[model samples]
Each structure stands twice: as C-alpha cells, then as structure tokens.
Target: MDIPYTSKPRPDTGLYNAKVGIWLFLASEVMLFGALFSSYILLRVGALEENWPHGLLNIPIGTFNTAVLIISSVTVVMAWASLKMKQFGRFKIFQAITVLCALAFLGIKSFEYKDKFTHYEVWKTDGTRMTGHIEGNPMFLTKAKLVAAGKDKIEFLADPHHYSEGKLKIGAQSGEHKHVEIAIGDIKRLSAFVPAHSTYFAIYFTLTALHALHVLGGAIVIGFLFGPGSKMWHTDPDRFTNRVEVAGLFWHFVDLVWIFLFPVLYLL
Candidate 1:
C-alpha cells in the first residue's frame, strides 16, 4: 500500500508572523510603562508641594532634547520606508542618522546631569551644603545704589508687602536700596516639598538612569542590525529588511517613552 502525502498550511494572521509578534510585545510594554507613570503621579501627589525638590527645570534644554527625540522618531520612519523600497543603501544611511541622533541626545543629557552635580543639586544621604549662588530676584532692592555700592551701614529689611508680592522693592525714600546678604542659614522656612538631600535626589537619579538604559538598549539593537555581523542576514535581503523594521519599532517605543517622561519629570 502507498502512503498518501499530507500537507497543512499555517494561518495567514493578516501580516507577517514576526510583525504580529512585535506588536503584541509592544502592547505588553505599553502596560508596563503605563503602570510606572501612574505610580509616579501617585507619589508626586502625596509629596508636600507640587514643586517638590525643585520648582522647575531648565525648560530650554529639556525642549531641545524633546526635539532631538522627535527627530529620531522621524528618521526611524524614513529608515523603515527605505527598507520597504528595497533601497538598502538609503536604509543604512537613515539608520545611521537615527543612531547619531540618539547619541546626540545622550550628549545633551550628560551636560544637564553634570550641571546638576556641579551645582550641588544632587541628593545626598547625609545633609550636604548646596554651594551655588541662588539667582537673586532684582526687585528686592530699596536703595539700589547703596546695595550696589556695598554699604554695610545700610539696613536692608524684608518688606512684608513686597515679599508677599514676590518682588523685592526698595524704599525710594531710603538713600538707596540696600543689598542684604542671604545665607542658607537664614532660610526660616523650607518648602515641605523639598526633600532633605536624600529621597528626592534618589528618585531623580533612578528615573533618569533607567531611561538612559533603555536608550542604550535601543542603540545596541540598531548596532546589531546595521553593523558588520549583519552580513549573514544581508545575504537574505528580505530577512535583513524585517530585522531593520523590528529594530525601528523598538527605537520608536523608546523615543515615545522619553516624550512622556520629559514633560512629567522636567517641565512639570
């Protein structure tokens, strides 16, 4: 007796199997980040003041970084399009540009982090003295020249009304607005929102470090897909293109997370 041949076709699943798998994986990732963000909001609300450790961050720098990540997202899309068009050379160029953008982002972030450290803005376990000059408010001078002249005899008293107005107004009648020396020791009240060197700093360092790790991981994936080791996959052009698309999806996700984080952590 002759045995009959048997064959069974796999389900279409509409898109390629790998692409479908990646989407499902990304959905799970969304749930993960959503949970973290929710936790961040809860913790932030329970804090003493909405300002928390710092009133606000440097908005311009944060905005620049935001633009960088947004541009990277666009470049990744262009890379995917290039791959689809079978323009391998163009695909490589776009992929390389995206990676450079990622590095540039990290460079700017480094400068921001360094600024915080150098200014003693970082959190400390044991109370540490912050050494930087506090940007003085200009409106506080009563006799401006006297203060500017550094006359020790001139008395500088905090005007309660002016203080309430959040401006430093000088007594025009007084010979000159006297400049008063403010010492950290003179701070009669500390914002309950300000963490005493430890808690707030820890949160900031931890959050930013984790985000940086994600960027690093994305970089590694892109490196593998476009680097020398890619030769074997390149032999099979279709597989190589699929790999690029998968990496693009991951890179885009990383960029999206940063967009949300930049506003919540820095701007707010």
Candidate 2:
C-alpha cells in the first residue's frame, strides 16, 4: 500500500511524515541525554572535591573534533541545499564530505579511548596515589593482572600532578614524568581510566559512547542516501530530497549533542 504524506506535507503539521517522525525521535533522544547529563551534575556535585578528576582529557584533541563536527554540520546543510537546487553532483560531493567528517570524528574518539585504556592510576598500600603510564604501555593493567603474570615490579612513568590535583594551565606543556619502580606488594589498587576506574570516567564513557553511536547511525543513513538510495532521485526527486532532508536533521542533532559534550567532558 502507498503511504500517505510520504512526499507531501500533512495539512495539520505542515511537515511530511518522515520529517514529523524524525522530530519525534529527536525529542526522545533529548530526554535520554538530558537524564544522563543531570546524573553527571549530581555525581560531580556530590563527589569529594579532591577526588573528582579534572584535566585528564586532552583539550586540544577535543577542540579539533569539535571543529570537525561543526564542519560536517555545515556540509550537511549544503548537501540538502544542493538537492533543493537540483544539483545532484554537488549534493553527492557535499554528502561525501559529511560522511568523511563523521569517520574522522570516530577515528579521533577511538584514539582518545585508547589513551585512557593505557593510562593508569595506582593506590599504594602506604596510602600514596599516583597516575601515569606503565613502561610497557599495557591496556587495562590491574594488580590482579600483574600477579597473574608473575610480575613483581613494574617500571612506571608517573605524572607530576594527579588529574584531580589541578586543571591544566593554558599553553602549559606537561611536566617531566618521574620514573618509579613500583613493587606489586606495595600496590593496593590499580586501574585504567575506564568506566570502573571512577564515577567521573563512568559517566564520561556513558555519555560519549552514546553520542558516538548516534553519529554512527546518522552516518549510515546519510551514506545510504548518498549511495544506492540516490536512485530515488531519478524516479522520485521530491521523495529523495525529503529523505536527504530528514537525514540532515538527524545529523545536525548529532552535531549539536557533541557541541555540548566537548566542553562538559573535556574542559570542565
């Protein structure tokens, strides 16, 4: 059966069926992210001041990703505009750039995640805590893992200041990383900057991972429209244009979420 309002706007809403559906979906997404954001605030506000992590995230990298998303947002709009002008070639070119930007954003995010996984924080039995890198650049290193490997000592490069100690000063380079040989017997706890590492990381992963999923999803849909789905442009130009418009809306929302996320997670 033919679907009503697939190409035409509904009189009551002045929006095609797909457009209306996308807006409704975005509304639900807002509530889902809003709840998570609220939880982050509560967790940070309630946590001990000295224990909350800060300056662990790389601000320069985050800012660069932010620019990538912003550029993708502009390209998505241009893609839609190209379709409106019946410039199929331009639409394809713009959409291709948008997809590439999405991929670049994902690639950078994976690098950041890897950095966190390799980085470590250790609590010694003597009540001293230190954070930095292990000599071997291991992923998810823990006390149990060290024991299971029969390793009695690890060569560590400790950062001058723990992440919780202070914010990263502007234009300041990292201080010298002190080398320390830590004995397994003196280790009380060991963890990477993963979800289980602390409450701050838990929320950080939850928020950024969810947003990455959205970016992936949007990229897939837009990719389809830019590829095989473009056949619709020949058979039904209006419907195909509507499809691109719908995908663009979702892309914009994905970009907007990251805009809020960059500063919250990386800067503050």
Q: Which candidate wins on lDDT? A: 2
Model 1 spans > 4 angstroms off: 1-10, 121-198
- Model 1 agreement with the true structure over 44-111: per-residue lDDT tens digits: 77876523444234668888988988988888888878877878788778878888888888888887
lDDT of 2 by residue, 93-186 (tens): 9999999999999999999999999999999999999988999899998899999999999999998887656676322645777999999999
Backbone clashes in model 2, listed as residue pairs: none
TM-score of each: 0.66, 0.97
In angstroms, the error of model 2 at 45 is 1.0
Residue 94 accuracy (lDDT) in model 1: 80
Q: Report the alpha-carbon TM-score of model 2 versus the true structure.
A: 0.97
User: Which stretches of candidate 2 lie above 4 Å from their native place?
Assistant: 169-171
Clashes of each: 10, 0
Error of 1 at 266 (Å): 1.8
